[model samples]
Target: MSEEGSSYDWAHKAFLQAFLSKSVMTVDEIKPILAAVMSARDPNRPTLEGDVTAPLISSTIQAINERLTSVDYEIRSTKDQTNKHTVYALVNTTSDSLTQLATTFTPDAIAYIKRVLDCMFETNNTRNREVMAVTSIQASQLAKAPTRSRQSQVGGDEDSSIQAEAAVKSLTIAESEKVLADLFDQDFIYKSRANYYSLAPRALMELRTYLKETYNEPAGDDEDEPAIVRIRDCDICREIVTVGVRCSNRECNVRFHDSCATQYFRSQRGNQRTCPKCKGEWLGDLFVGERAANKGQRRTTGGRSSNVRSEEEEEEDEDE
Candidate 1:
Protein backbone atom coordinates (compact mmCIF):
# COMPACT_ATOMS: atom_id res chain seq x y z
CA MET A 1 0.00 0.00 0.00
CA SER A 2 1.18 3.53 -0.75
CA GLU A 3 2.34 5.64 2.24
CA GLU A 4 3.72 9.11 2.91
CA GLY A 5 7.42 8.19 3.05
CA SER A 6 9.80 5.71 1.42
CA SER A 7 9.02 2.42 3.09
CA TYR A 8 12.66 1.36 3.46
CA ASP A 9 13.98 4.18 5.64
CA TRP A 10 10.63 4.55 7.37
CA ALA A 11 10.61 0.94 8.47
CA HIS A 12 14.23 1.10 9.67
CA LYS A 13 13.55 4.16 11.81
CA ALA A 14 10.43 2.54 13.18
CA PHE A 15 12.35 -0.61 14.05
CA LEU A 16 15.05 1.35 15.83
CA GLN A 17 12.54 3.43 17.80
CA ALA A 18 10.55 0.38 18.81
CA PHE A 19 13.74 -1.40 19.79
CA LEU A 20 15.01 1.48 21.95
CA SER A 21 11.76 2.41 23.68
CA LYS A 22 11.25 -1.14 24.98
CA SER A 23 7.64 -0.38 24.39
CA VAL A 24 5.25 -0.56 21.50
CA MET A 25 4.45 2.69 19.64
CA THR A 26 1.30 3.52 17.67
CA VAL A 27 1.06 3.64 13.87
CA ASP A 28 0.22 7.34 14.04
CA GLU A 29 3.42 8.00 15.97
CA ILE A 30 5.49 6.01 13.48
CA LYS A 31 3.93 7.32 10.23
CA PRO A 32 5.23 10.88 10.24
CA ILE A 33 8.71 9.81 11.38
CA LEU A 34 8.86 7.13 8.72
CA ALA A 35 7.60 9.51 6.06
CA ALA A 36 10.33 11.99 6.93
CA VAL A 37 13.03 9.30 6.92
CA MET A 38 11.96 7.86 3.58
CA SER A 39 11.99 11.27 1.97
CA ALA A 40 15.10 12.39 3.89
CA ARG A 41 13.29 15.70 4.22
CA ASP A 42 13.10 17.98 7.23
CA PRO A 43 11.45 16.03 10.03
CA ASN A 44 9.33 19.05 10.90
CA ARG A 45 6.70 18.48 8.27
CA PRO A 46 3.58 20.67 8.48
CA THR A 47 1.57 17.46 8.84
CA LEU A 48 1.43 13.89 7.66
CA GLU A 49 0.33 13.66 4.01
CA GLY A 50 -0.91 10.92 1.66
CA ASP A 51 -4.43 9.45 1.42
CA VAL A 52 -4.58 9.75 5.21
CA THR A 53 -8.33 9.76 5.01
CA ALA A 54 -9.52 7.30 7.66
CA PRO A 55 -10.53 4.55 5.22
CA LEU A 56 -7.31 4.75 3.19
CA ILE A 57 -5.16 4.77 6.31
CA SER A 58 -7.11 1.81 7.69
CA SER A 59 -6.64 -0.13 4.45
CA THR A 60 -2.90 0.50 4.48
CA ILE A 61 -2.66 -0.53 8.12
CA GLN A 62 -4.71 -3.61 7.36
CA ALA A 63 -2.34 -4.53 4.55
CA ILE A 64 0.61 -4.24 6.93
CA ASN A 65 -1.27 -6.22 9.57
CA GLU A 66 -1.99 -9.03 7.14
CA ARG A 67 1.62 -9.14 5.95
CA LEU A 68 2.95 -9.13 9.51
CA THR A 69 0.41 -11.69 10.74
CA SER A 70 1.70 -14.44 8.43
CA VAL A 71 5.08 -14.08 10.15
CA ASP A 72 3.55 -13.81 13.65
CA TYR A 73 4.36 -10.14 14.19
CA GLU A 74 1.97 -8.66 16.76
CA ILE A 75 0.63 -5.19 15.99
CA ARG A 76 -1.89 -3.20 17.97
CA SER A 77 -3.57 0.15 17.46
CA THR A 78 -4.78 2.43 20.24
CA LYS A 79 -6.39 5.85 20.33
CA ASP A 80 -6.46 8.27 23.24
CA GLN A 81 -9.68 10.24 23.09
CA THR A 82 -8.49 12.83 25.64
CA ASN A 83 -5.21 13.45 23.78
CA LYS A 84 -6.77 12.88 20.30
CA HIS A 85 -3.81 10.71 19.29
CA THR A 86 -3.50 7.31 17.59
CA VAL A 87 -0.52 4.90 17.73
CA TYR A 88 0.62 1.52 16.39
CA ALA A 89 2.78 -0.92 18.30
CA LEU A 90 4.89 -3.59 16.57
CA VAL A 91 6.00 -6.61 18.55
CA ASN A 92 9.11 -8.56 17.59
CA THR A 93 8.99 -12.06 16.08
CA THR A 94 11.24 -15.09 16.55
CA SER A 95 14.73 -14.91 15.03
CA ASP A 96 14.20 -17.79 12.59
CA SER A 97 11.00 -16.27 11.26
CA LEU A 98 12.61 -12.85 10.93
CA THR A 99 15.50 -14.24 8.91
CA GLN A 100 13.12 -16.12 6.63
CA LEU A 101 10.96 -13.03 6.14
CA ALA A 102 13.96 -10.86 5.39
CA THR A 103 15.45 -13.19 2.77
CA THR A 104 12.27 -14.00 0.88
CA PHE A 105 10.04 -11.20 -0.42
CA THR A 106 7.56 -10.77 -3.24
CA PRO A 107 9.10 -9.19 -6.36
CA ASP A 108 7.03 -6.01 -5.92
CA ALA A 109 8.30 -5.43 -2.38
CA ILE A 110 11.84 -6.81 -2.80
CA ALA A 111 13.75 -3.54 -3.09
CA TYR A 112 12.08 -1.65 -0.25
CA ILE A 113 11.72 -4.68 1.97
CA LYS A 114 15.39 -5.62 1.53
CA ARG A 115 16.61 -2.22 2.68
CA VAL A 116 14.32 -2.13 5.70
CA LEU A 117 14.97 -5.71 6.71
CA ASP A 118 18.71 -5.43 6.20
CA CYS A 119 18.93 -2.30 8.31
CA MET A 120 16.75 -3.65 11.10
CA PHE A 121 17.27 -7.40 11.16
CA GLU A 122 20.81 -7.80 9.74
CA THR A 123 20.46 -10.74 7.34
CA ASN A 124 23.29 -12.05 5.12
CA ASN A 125 22.30 -10.54 1.80
CA THR A 126 25.86 -10.70 0.47
CA ARG A 127 26.02 -14.47 0.77
CA ASN A 128 22.44 -14.88 -0.40
CA ARG A 129 23.06 -12.75 -3.49
CA GLU A 130 26.33 -14.47 -4.21
CA VAL A 131 24.69 -17.89 -4.00
CA MET A 132 21.87 -16.83 -6.32
CA ALA A 133 24.29 -15.25 -8.80
CA VAL A 134 26.60 -18.27 -8.82
CA THR A 135 23.73 -20.70 -9.25
CA SER A 136 22.48 -18.66 -12.20
CA ILE A 137 25.93 -18.70 -13.75
CA GLN A 138 26.27 -22.44 -13.27
CA ALA A 139 22.86 -23.04 -14.84
CA SER A 140 23.79 -20.92 -17.85
CA GLN A 141 27.10 -22.73 -18.25
CA LEU A 142 25.42 -26.11 -18.04
CA ALA A 143 22.99 -25.08 -20.76
CA LYS A 144 25.88 -24.20 -23.06
CA ALA A 145 28.90 -26.62 -23.97
CA PRO A 146 26.98 -28.07 -26.91
CA THR A 147 26.97 -31.83 -27.30
CA ARG A 148 29.35 -33.54 -29.72
CA SER A 149 26.48 -33.95 -32.18
CA ARG A 150 26.16 -30.16 -32.56
CA GLN A 151 29.83 -29.57 -33.38
CA SER A 152 29.21 -30.12 -37.11
CA GLN A 153 26.70 -27.28 -37.23
CA VAL A 154 28.71 -24.24 -38.38
CA GLY A 155 26.08 -21.47 -38.63
CA GLY A 156 24.37 -21.78 -35.25
CA ASP A 157 24.00 -18.08 -34.44
CA GLU A 158 21.35 -18.72 -31.80
CA ASP A 159 23.48 -21.34 -30.06
CA SER A 160 26.53 -19.09 -30.24
CA SER A 161 24.59 -16.18 -28.68
CA ILE A 162 23.30 -18.42 -25.90
CA GLN A 163 26.85 -19.63 -25.22
CA ALA A 164 28.08 -16.05 -25.17
CA GLU A 165 25.44 -15.12 -22.60
CA ALA A 166 26.54 -18.02 -20.45
CA ALA A 167 30.16 -16.87 -20.67
CA VAL A 168 29.18 -13.36 -19.61
CA LYS A 169 27.16 -14.76 -16.73
CA SER A 170 30.13 -16.83 -15.58
CA LEU A 171 32.36 -13.77 -15.72
CA THR A 172 29.91 -11.76 -13.62
CA ILE A 173 29.81 -14.50 -11.01
CA ALA A 174 33.60 -14.66 -10.98
CA GLU A 175 33.87 -10.91 -10.51
CA SER A 176 31.43 -10.86 -7.62
CA GLU A 177 33.18 -13.80 -5.99
CA LYS A 178 36.54 -12.14 -6.51
CA VAL A 179 35.37 -9.01 -4.67
CA LEU A 180 34.31 -11.08 -1.68
CA ALA A 181 37.33 -13.34 -1.85
CA ASP A 182 39.67 -10.38 -1.94
CA LEU A 183 37.80 -8.72 0.88
CA PHE A 184 37.71 -11.80 3.06
CA ASP A 185 40.65 -13.76 1.74
CA GLN A 186 38.19 -16.58 1.47
CA ASP A 187 40.36 -18.43 -0.99
CA PHE A 188 43.02 -18.73 1.69
CA ILE A 189 40.68 -18.76 4.68
CA TYR A 190 38.44 -21.48 3.30
CA LYS A 191 38.94 -24.57 1.21
CA SER A 192 38.67 -24.77 -2.57
CA ARG A 193 36.92 -27.46 -4.57
CA ALA A 194 37.76 -27.99 -8.23
CA ASN A 195 39.17 -24.44 -8.22
CA TYR A 196 35.70 -23.20 -7.14
CA TYR A 197 36.53 -21.62 -3.81
CA SER A 198 34.03 -21.09 -0.98
CA LEU A 199 33.62 -20.96 2.75
CA ALA A 200 32.06 -24.01 4.32
CA PRO A 201 28.26 -23.99 4.37
CA ARG A 202 28.42 -24.43 8.14
CA ALA A 203 30.62 -21.36 8.47
CA LEU A 204 28.22 -19.24 6.44
CA MET A 205 25.30 -20.60 8.45
CA GLU A 206 27.11 -19.69 11.65
CA LEU A 207 27.74 -16.18 10.39
CA ARG A 208 24.04 -15.82 9.61
CA THR A 209 23.05 -17.09 13.03
CA TYR A 210 25.52 -14.84 14.85
CA LEU A 211 24.39 -11.73 12.97
CA LYS A 212 20.74 -12.50 13.68
CA GLU A 213 21.36 -13.18 17.36
CA THR A 214 23.56 -10.12 17.78
CA TYR A 215 21.24 -7.63 16.05
CA ASN A 216 17.74 -9.08 16.48
CA GLU A 217 17.79 -10.06 20.14
CA PRO A 218 15.92 -8.04 22.78
CA ALA A 219 17.14 -4.46 23.11
CA GLY A 220 20.18 -4.14 25.38
CA ASP A 221 22.52 -1.55 26.90
CA ASP A 222 25.48 -2.12 24.56
CA GLU A 223 25.95 -0.40 21.21
CA ASP A 224 26.34 -2.53 18.09
CA GLU A 225 29.67 -2.72 16.28
CA PRO A 226 30.06 -1.49 12.73
CA ALA A 227 30.48 -3.81 9.75
CA ILE A 228 33.92 -5.36 9.24
CA VAL A 229 35.88 -5.07 6.00
CA ARG A 230 38.18 -8.08 5.22
CA ILE A 231 41.42 -7.42 3.40
CA ARG A 232 45.07 -8.44 3.26
CA ASP A 233 47.95 -6.42 4.70
CA CYS A 234 50.10 -4.50 2.24
CA ASP A 235 53.65 -5.85 1.80
CA ILE A 236 55.12 -2.36 1.41
CA CYS A 237 53.17 -0.48 4.06
CA ARG A 238 51.79 -3.42 6.03
CA GLU A 239 48.35 -1.89 6.45
CA ILE A 240 45.44 -4.24 7.23
CA VAL A 241 42.64 -4.20 4.68
CA THR A 242 39.66 -6.04 3.32
CA VAL A 243 40.42 -5.28 -0.29
CA GLY A 244 43.48 -3.76 -1.96
CA VAL A 245 42.95 -0.21 -3.15
CA ARG A 246 45.04 -0.34 -6.31
CA CYS A 247 47.36 -2.60 -8.26
CA SER A 248 51.08 -2.50 -7.47
CA ASN A 249 51.51 -2.35 -11.21
CA ARG A 250 49.10 -2.68 -14.10
CA GLU A 251 50.99 -5.62 -15.58
CA CYS A 252 51.88 -7.30 -12.27
CA ASN A 253 48.33 -7.85 -11.02
CA VAL A 254 49.81 -7.19 -7.56
CA ARG A 255 47.49 -5.31 -5.24
CA PHE A 256 48.20 -3.18 -2.19
CA HIS A 257 46.16 -1.62 0.53
CA ASP A 258 44.95 1.88 -0.39
CA SER A 259 46.91 3.58 2.35
CA CYS A 260 50.08 1.81 1.38
CA ALA A 261 49.87 2.70 -2.32
CA THR A 262 47.72 5.83 -2.34
CA GLN A 263 50.64 8.24 -2.27
CA TYR A 264 52.08 6.81 -5.49
CA PHE A 265 48.99 6.37 -7.66
CA ARG A 266 45.94 8.17 -6.25
CA SER A 267 46.95 11.47 -7.78
CA GLN A 268 47.45 10.05 -11.28
CA ARG A 269 44.68 10.54 -13.81
CA GLY A 270 45.33 7.56 -16.10
CA ASN A 271 47.98 5.34 -17.64
CA GLN A 272 50.54 6.99 -15.38
CA ARG A 273 50.88 4.19 -12.85
CA THR A 274 54.26 2.88 -11.60
CA CYS A 275 55.51 -0.02 -9.50
CA PRO A 276 54.90 0.65 -5.84
CA LYS A 277 58.20 -0.85 -4.73
CA CYS A 278 60.55 0.08 -7.57
CA LYS A 279 58.78 3.25 -8.77
CA GLY A 280 59.58 2.15 -12.34
CA GLU A 281 57.27 3.13 -15.18
CA TRP A 282 54.79 0.28 -15.52
CA LEU A 283 55.67 -0.46 -19.15
CA GLY A 284 58.97 1.35 -19.56
CA ASP A 285 61.93 -0.61 -20.88
CA LEU A 286 64.05 -0.71 -17.76
CA PHE A 287 65.91 -3.37 -19.67
CA VAL A 288 66.38 -1.32 -22.85
CA GLY A 289 68.05 -4.20 -24.77
CA GLU A 290 68.04 -6.91 -22.10
CA ARG A 291 66.31 -9.39 -24.40
CA ALA A 292 69.12 -8.88 -26.92
CA ALA A 293 71.83 -8.64 -24.23
CA ASN A 294 71.02 -11.89 -22.45
CA LYS A 295 68.62 -14.41 -23.86
CA GLY A 296 68.03 -16.05 -20.44
CA GLN A 297 67.94 -12.95 -18.27
CA ARG A 298 64.58 -12.21 -16.66
CA ARG A 299 63.02 -8.76 -17.08
CA THR A 300 63.66 -7.52 -13.54
CA THR A 301 64.98 -4.33 -11.99
CA GLY A 302 68.11 -5.87 -10.49
CA GLY A 303 69.12 -7.43 -13.82
CA ARG A 304 68.46 -4.14 -15.65
CA SER A 305 70.47 -2.16 -13.06
CA SER A 306 73.45 -4.49 -13.31
CA ASN A 307 73.33 -4.31 -17.13
CA VAL A 308 73.45 -0.49 -16.98
CA ARG A 309 76.42 -0.62 -14.60
CA SER A 310 78.21 -3.07 -16.89
CA GLU A 311 77.70 -0.78 -19.88
CA GLU A 312 79.12 2.24 -17.94
CA GLU A 313 82.16 0.17 -16.87
CA GLU A 314 82.91 -0.81 -20.51
CA GLU A 315 82.65 2.88 -21.61
CA GLU A 316 85.15 3.86 -18.87
CA ASP A 317 87.57 1.14 -20.03
CA GLU A 318 87.46 2.57 -23.58
CA ASP A 319 88.22 6.06 -22.19
CA GLU A 320 91.24 4.70 -20.23
Candidate 2:
Protein backbone atom coordinates (compact mmCIF):
# COMPACT_ATOMS: atom_id res chain seq x y z
CA MET A 1 0.00 0.00 0.00
CA SER A 2 1.04 3.60 -0.54
CA GLU A 3 2.66 5.39 2.39
CA GLU A 4 -0.11 7.94 2.66
CA GLY A 5 -2.66 5.16 2.64
CA SER A 6 -0.82 3.44 5.42
CA SER A 7 -0.85 6.61 7.47
CA TYR A 8 -4.58 7.05 6.92
CA ASP A 9 -5.19 3.46 7.93
CA TRP A 10 -3.34 4.00 11.19
CA ALA A 11 -5.15 7.26 11.72
CA HIS A 12 -8.53 5.71 11.00
CA LYS A 13 -7.96 2.90 13.49
CA ALA A 14 -6.82 5.36 16.12
CA PHE A 15 -9.78 7.57 15.43
CA LEU A 16 -12.25 4.75 15.96
CA GLN A 17 -10.64 3.79 19.25
CA ALA A 18 -10.45 7.32 20.62
CA PHE A 19 -13.94 8.16 19.43
CA LEU A 20 -15.42 5.23 21.35
CA SER A 21 -13.71 5.91 24.69
CA LYS A 22 -15.38 9.00 26.04
CA SER A 23 -18.38 9.36 28.41
CA VAL A 24 -19.40 12.47 26.41
CA MET A 25 -18.33 12.88 22.78
CA THR A 26 -17.64 16.30 21.35
CA VAL A 27 -16.01 17.47 18.16
CA ASP A 28 -12.91 18.82 19.92
CA GLU A 29 -12.37 15.58 21.89
CA ILE A 30 -11.62 13.38 18.88
CA LYS A 31 -8.08 14.56 18.11
CA PRO A 32 -6.68 13.76 21.56
CA ILE A 33 -8.25 10.33 21.59
CA LEU A 34 -6.77 9.68 18.20
CA ALA A 35 -3.37 10.85 19.42
CA ALA A 36 -3.55 8.48 22.42
CA VAL A 37 -4.46 5.41 20.36
CA MET A 38 -1.80 6.10 17.73
CA SER A 39 0.78 6.57 20.47
CA ALA A 40 0.05 3.09 21.83
CA ARG A 41 0.18 1.15 18.55
CA ASP A 42 2.84 0.58 15.93
CA PRO A 43 1.82 2.60 12.90
CA ASN A 44 3.39 0.17 10.45
CA ARG A 45 1.73 -2.99 11.76
CA PRO A 46 -1.20 -4.19 9.68
CA THR A 47 -2.55 -6.38 12.38
CA LEU A 48 -2.30 -6.22 16.16
CA GLU A 49 -2.23 -9.57 18.06
CA GLY A 50 -0.91 -11.58 21.06
CA ASP A 51 -2.06 -12.01 24.72
CA VAL A 52 0.14 -9.09 25.90
CA THR A 53 -1.66 -6.84 23.35
CA ALA A 54 -5.09 -8.03 24.43
CA PRO A 55 -5.72 -5.39 27.13
CA LEU A 56 -5.01 -2.41 24.84
CA ILE A 57 -7.14 -4.03 22.20
CA SER A 58 -9.93 -4.68 24.68
CA SER A 59 -9.82 -1.17 26.07
CA THR A 60 -9.96 0.39 22.62
CA ILE A 61 -12.73 -1.96 21.53
CA GLN A 62 -14.79 -1.35 24.68
CA ALA A 63 -14.47 2.38 24.23
CA ILE A 64 -15.73 2.11 20.66
CA ASN A 65 -18.70 -0.03 21.73
CA GLU A 66 -19.56 2.38 24.48
CA ARG A 67 -19.51 5.33 22.09
CA LEU A 68 -21.54 3.47 19.48
CA THR A 69 -24.03 2.30 22.10
CA SER A 70 -24.59 5.90 23.19
CA VAL A 71 -25.25 6.98 19.62
CA ASP A 72 -27.41 4.01 18.55
CA TYR A 73 -30.26 2.47 20.53
CA GLU A 74 -29.81 -0.86 18.74
CA ILE A 75 -26.19 -1.03 19.87
CA ARG A 76 -27.15 0.06 23.34
CA SER A 77 -29.56 -2.85 23.68
CA THR A 78 -27.07 -5.36 22.20
CA LYS A 79 -24.09 -3.98 24.16
CA ASP A 80 -24.02 -6.73 26.87
CA GLN A 81 -23.97 -9.49 24.28
CA THR A 82 -20.75 -8.12 22.66
CA ASN A 83 -18.71 -7.31 25.79
CA LYS A 84 -15.68 -9.52 25.14
CA HIS A 85 -15.93 -9.63 21.34
CA THR A 86 -13.06 -8.75 19.04
CA VAL A 87 -12.49 -5.13 17.94
CA TYR A 88 -13.48 -5.98 14.36
CA ALA A 89 -17.07 -6.66 15.44
CA LEU A 90 -17.91 -2.98 16.02
CA VAL A 91 -16.31 -1.82 12.72
CA ASN A 92 -18.65 -2.77 9.91
CA THR A 93 -16.82 -2.18 6.64
CA THR A 94 -16.68 -4.54 3.68
CA SER A 95 -13.35 -5.35 2.03
CA ASP A 96 -14.87 -4.83 -1.40
CA SER A 97 -16.12 -1.36 -0.54
CA LEU A 98 -12.71 -0.40 0.81
CA THR A 99 -10.93 -1.80 -2.22
CA GLN A 100 -13.24 -0.01 -4.61
CA LEU A 101 -12.85 3.28 -2.78
CA ALA A 102 -9.06 3.04 -2.94
CA THR A 103 -9.02 2.29 -6.65
CA THR A 104 -11.83 4.49 -7.90
CA PHE A 105 -13.02 7.92 -6.94
CA THR A 106 -16.62 9.08 -7.01
CA PRO A 107 -17.66 11.06 -10.09
CA ASP A 108 -17.50 14.30 -8.12
CA ALA A 109 -14.03 13.44 -6.83
CA ILE A 110 -12.82 12.49 -10.30
CA ALA A 111 -13.88 15.87 -11.64
CA TYR A 112 -11.96 17.52 -8.84
CA ILE A 113 -8.81 15.55 -9.69
CA LYS A 114 -9.09 16.47 -13.37
CA ARG A 115 -9.24 20.18 -12.66
CA VAL A 116 -5.77 20.06 -11.20
CA LEU A 117 -4.50 17.97 -14.12
CA ASP A 118 -5.93 20.45 -16.58
CA CYS A 119 -3.84 23.18 -15.01
CA MET A 120 -0.64 21.19 -15.33
CA PHE A 121 -1.27 20.03 -18.92
CA GLU A 122 -2.06 23.58 -20.05
CA THR A 123 1.57 24.57 -19.58
CA ASN A 124 2.83 23.07 -22.89
CA ASN A 125 3.36 25.14 -26.10
CA THR A 126 3.37 22.92 -29.22
CA ARG A 127 -0.01 21.51 -28.23
CA ASN A 128 -1.18 25.11 -28.01
CA ARG A 129 -0.22 25.71 -31.67
CA GLU A 130 -2.31 22.75 -32.77
CA VAL A 131 -5.30 24.10 -30.83
CA MET A 132 -4.92 27.59 -32.38
CA ALA A 133 -4.85 26.03 -35.82
CA VAL A 134 -8.30 24.49 -35.30
CA THR A 135 -9.91 27.56 -33.72
CA SER A 136 -8.55 29.74 -36.53
CA ILE A 137 -10.19 27.37 -38.98
CA GLN A 138 -13.57 27.62 -37.20
CA ALA A 139 -13.51 31.41 -36.77
CA SER A 140 -12.32 31.83 -40.36
CA GLN A 141 -15.17 29.65 -41.60
CA LEU A 142 -17.30 32.71 -42.41
CA ALA A 143 -14.44 34.13 -44.41
CA LYS A 144 -13.83 30.78 -46.09
CA ALA A 145 -17.59 30.33 -46.67
CA PRO A 146 -17.68 33.46 -48.77
CA THR A 147 -15.02 32.07 -51.09
CA ARG A 148 -17.18 29.00 -51.62
CA SER A 149 -20.22 31.21 -52.16
CA ARG A 150 -18.32 33.25 -54.76
CA GLN A 151 -17.20 30.13 -56.57
CA SER A 152 -20.78 28.74 -56.49
CA GLN A 153 -22.15 32.02 -57.84
CA VAL A 154 -19.75 31.96 -60.77
CA GLY A 155 -20.17 28.21 -61.50
CA GLY A 156 -23.68 27.16 -60.47
CA ASP A 157 -23.80 23.97 -62.54
CA GLU A 158 -20.25 22.76 -61.75
CA ASP A 159 -20.92 20.55 -58.71
CA SER A 160 -17.65 18.63 -59.29
CA SER A 161 -15.54 21.79 -58.82
CA ILE A 162 -17.34 22.62 -55.58
CA GLN A 163 -16.79 19.09 -54.28
CA ALA A 164 -13.09 19.31 -55.16
CA GLU A 165 -12.71 22.59 -53.32
CA ALA A 166 -14.52 21.17 -50.28
CA ALA A 167 -12.29 18.11 -50.30
CA VAL A 168 -9.21 20.36 -50.39
CA LYS A 169 -10.42 22.58 -47.52
CA SER A 170 -11.40 19.69 -45.29
CA LEU A 171 -8.57 18.36 -43.10
CA THR A 172 -9.53 14.80 -44.03
CA ILE A 173 -6.91 14.22 -46.74
CA ALA A 174 -3.23 15.01 -45.95
CA GLU A 175 -2.78 18.78 -45.58
CA SER A 176 -1.70 19.80 -42.07
CA GLU A 177 -4.28 22.61 -41.95
CA LYS A 178 -7.35 20.46 -42.66
CA VAL A 179 -6.04 17.60 -40.57
CA LEU A 180 -5.59 19.92 -37.60
CA ALA A 181 -8.95 21.56 -38.23
CA ASP A 182 -10.95 18.34 -38.31
CA LEU A 183 -9.09 17.06 -35.26
CA PHE A 184 -10.11 20.14 -33.32
CA ASP A 185 -13.75 19.88 -34.43
CA GLN A 186 -14.24 16.50 -32.77
CA ASP A 187 -16.51 16.55 -29.66
CA PHE A 188 -13.68 15.05 -27.65
CA ILE A 189 -11.89 18.27 -28.46
CA TYR A 190 -11.99 20.86 -25.69
CA LYS A 191 -10.52 24.09 -26.98
CA SER A 192 -9.31 26.71 -24.54
CA ARG A 193 -8.65 29.22 -27.32
CA ALA A 194 -7.97 29.59 -31.04
CA ASN A 195 -4.78 27.52 -30.97
CA TYR A 196 -5.57 24.97 -28.26
CA TYR A 197 -7.53 21.74 -28.00
CA SER A 198 -7.60 18.82 -25.59
CA LEU A 199 -8.65 15.15 -25.67
CA ALA A 200 -11.07 15.29 -22.81
CA PRO A 201 -13.60 12.71 -21.70
CA ARG A 202 -16.83 12.37 -23.71
CA ALA A 203 -14.61 12.60 -26.78
CA LEU A 204 -12.72 10.43 -29.24
CA MET A 205 -9.51 8.61 -28.45
CA GLU A 206 -6.17 9.00 -30.23
CA LEU A 207 -5.54 6.31 -32.78
CA ARG A 208 -2.27 4.34 -32.94
CA THR A 209 -1.92 4.96 -36.69
CA TYR A 210 -2.17 8.74 -36.32
CA LEU A 211 0.52 8.79 -33.68
CA LYS A 212 2.91 6.73 -35.81
CA GLU A 213 2.31 8.92 -38.88
CA THR A 214 2.37 12.40 -37.33
CA TYR A 215 5.07 11.97 -34.69
CA ASN A 216 8.50 10.67 -35.76
CA GLU A 217 8.30 8.03 -33.05
CA PRO A 218 7.63 4.44 -34.12
CA ALA A 219 4.16 2.96 -33.60
CA GLY A 220 5.09 -0.12 -31.60
CA ASP A 221 7.76 0.01 -28.91
CA ASP A 222 10.35 2.37 -27.45
CA GLU A 223 13.06 0.02 -26.24
CA ASP A 224 15.75 2.70 -26.05
CA GLU A 225 13.72 4.88 -23.71
CA PRO A 226 13.94 4.58 -19.93
CA ALA A 227 11.56 2.24 -18.12
CA ILE A 228 9.92 5.20 -16.42
CA VAL A 229 7.74 6.83 -19.07
CA ARG A 230 5.36 9.74 -19.15
CA ILE A 231 2.85 9.83 -21.95
CA ARG A 232 -0.57 11.41 -22.30
CA ASP A 233 -2.99 11.64 -25.21
CA CYS A 234 -4.10 15.14 -26.19
CA ASP A 235 -7.36 15.93 -24.41
CA ILE A 236 -8.62 17.87 -27.46
CA CYS A 237 -7.26 16.11 -30.52
CA ARG A 238 -7.37 12.57 -29.21
CA GLU A 239 -3.81 12.45 -30.49
CA ILE A 240 -1.32 10.31 -28.66
CA VAL A 241 1.80 12.00 -27.43
CA THR A 242 4.68 11.05 -29.75
CA VAL A 243 7.11 13.32 -27.96
CA GLY A 244 8.72 12.05 -24.77
CA VAL A 245 7.58 13.98 -21.69
CA ARG A 246 5.96 13.92 -18.28
CA CYS A 247 3.43 16.15 -16.52
CA SER A 248 5.44 18.94 -14.81
CA ASN A 249 3.14 19.12 -11.82
CA ARG A 250 5.04 17.66 -8.83
CA GLU A 251 1.91 16.75 -6.93
CA CYS A 252 0.38 15.04 -9.97
CA ASN A 253 2.05 11.92 -11.33
CA VAL A 254 0.50 12.12 -14.81
CA ARG A 255 2.74 11.82 -17.86
CA PHE A 256 2.23 12.83 -21.47
CA HIS A 257 4.10 12.75 -24.73
CA ASP A 258 5.82 16.07 -25.43
CA SER A 259 3.51 17.15 -28.23
CA CYS A 260 0.37 15.99 -26.47
CA ALA A 261 1.43 17.65 -23.22
CA THR A 262 2.19 20.91 -24.98
CA GLN A 263 -1.21 21.02 -26.63
CA TYR A 264 -3.00 20.18 -23.38
CA PHE A 265 -1.13 22.81 -21.40
CA ARG A 266 -1.47 25.50 -24.06
CA SER A 267 -5.20 24.88 -24.31
CA GLN A 268 -5.40 25.45 -20.58
CA ARG A 269 -3.89 28.91 -20.50
CA GLY A 270 -6.35 31.65 -19.37
CA ASN A 271 -8.70 28.76 -18.59
CA GLN A 272 -9.57 26.41 -15.78
CA ARG A 273 -7.40 23.31 -15.10
CA THR A 274 -9.61 20.29 -14.65
CA CYS A 275 -9.28 16.56 -15.12
CA PRO A 276 -11.48 15.33 -17.94
CA LYS A 277 -12.46 12.31 -15.89
CA CYS A 278 -12.96 13.58 -12.32
CA LYS A 279 -13.03 17.33 -12.88
CA GLY A 280 -11.29 17.77 -9.54
CA GLU A 281 -8.88 20.58 -8.65
CA TRP A 282 -5.29 19.37 -9.16
CA LEU A 283 -4.08 21.32 -6.15
CA GLY A 284 -7.10 21.23 -3.87
CA ASP A 285 -10.61 19.86 -3.38
CA LEU A 286 -13.82 21.53 -4.49
CA PHE A 287 -17.23 19.88 -4.74
CA VAL A 288 -19.54 21.50 -7.32
CA GLY A 289 -22.03 18.70 -7.95
CA GLU A 290 -24.62 19.91 -5.45
CA ARG A 291 -24.38 23.47 -6.68
CA ALA A 292 -24.60 22.52 -10.34
CA ALA A 293 -27.50 20.13 -9.69
CA ASN A 294 -29.32 22.73 -7.60
CA LYS A 295 -28.93 25.31 -10.35
CA GLY A 296 -30.24 22.84 -12.96
CA GLN A 297 -33.19 21.94 -10.75
CA ARG A 298 -34.07 25.63 -10.32
CA ARG A 299 -33.96 26.17 -14.08
CA THR A 300 -36.16 23.13 -14.68
CA THR A 301 -38.74 24.32 -12.12
CA GLY A 302 -38.72 28.02 -12.98
CA GLY A 303 -40.75 28.02 -16.26
CA ARG A 304 -42.97 25.05 -15.38
CA SER A 305 -46.32 26.91 -15.68
CA SER A 306 -45.47 28.15 -19.20
CA ASN A 307 -44.23 24.70 -20.20
CA VAL A 308 -47.45 23.14 -18.90
CA ARG A 309 -49.55 25.63 -20.88
CA SER A 310 -47.60 24.81 -24.08
CA GLU A 311 -48.00 21.08 -23.47
CA GLU A 312 -51.81 21.49 -22.95
CA GLU A 313 -52.07 23.45 -26.23
CA GLU A 314 -50.20 20.73 -28.13
CA GLU A 315 -52.56 18.07 -26.71
CA GLU A 316 -55.64 20.19 -27.64
CA ASP A 317 -54.31 20.63 -31.21
CA GLU A 318 -53.97 16.85 -31.58
CA ASP A 319 -57.54 16.31 -30.27
CA GLU A 320 -58.94 18.83 -32.78
Compute the lDDT of residue 37 as modeled in candidate 1: 40
lDDT of 2 by residue, 180-270 (tens): 3443443223444434334432121212222233232333466565232123344443334322332322223343434444466577755
Best-fitting candidate, measured by lDDT? 1
Error of 2 at 209 (Å): 4.0
Stretches of candidate 1 off by over 4 Å are 1-22, 26-28, 38-57, 80-85, 92-320
Q: What local lDDT score does residue 309 receive in model 1, on the 0 to 100 scale?
A: 42
lDDT of 1 by residue, 125-239 (tens): 1111111112223322332232333223367677775654443222233443443343233211232232322222222222333334543345355567533322223455442
lDDT value, candidate 1, whole model: 0.36
Candidate 1 colliding pairs, count: 9
Give the distance in Å from residue 257's predicted Cα in candidate 1 to where it truly belongs. 68
**Candidate 2, overall lDDT?**
0.33
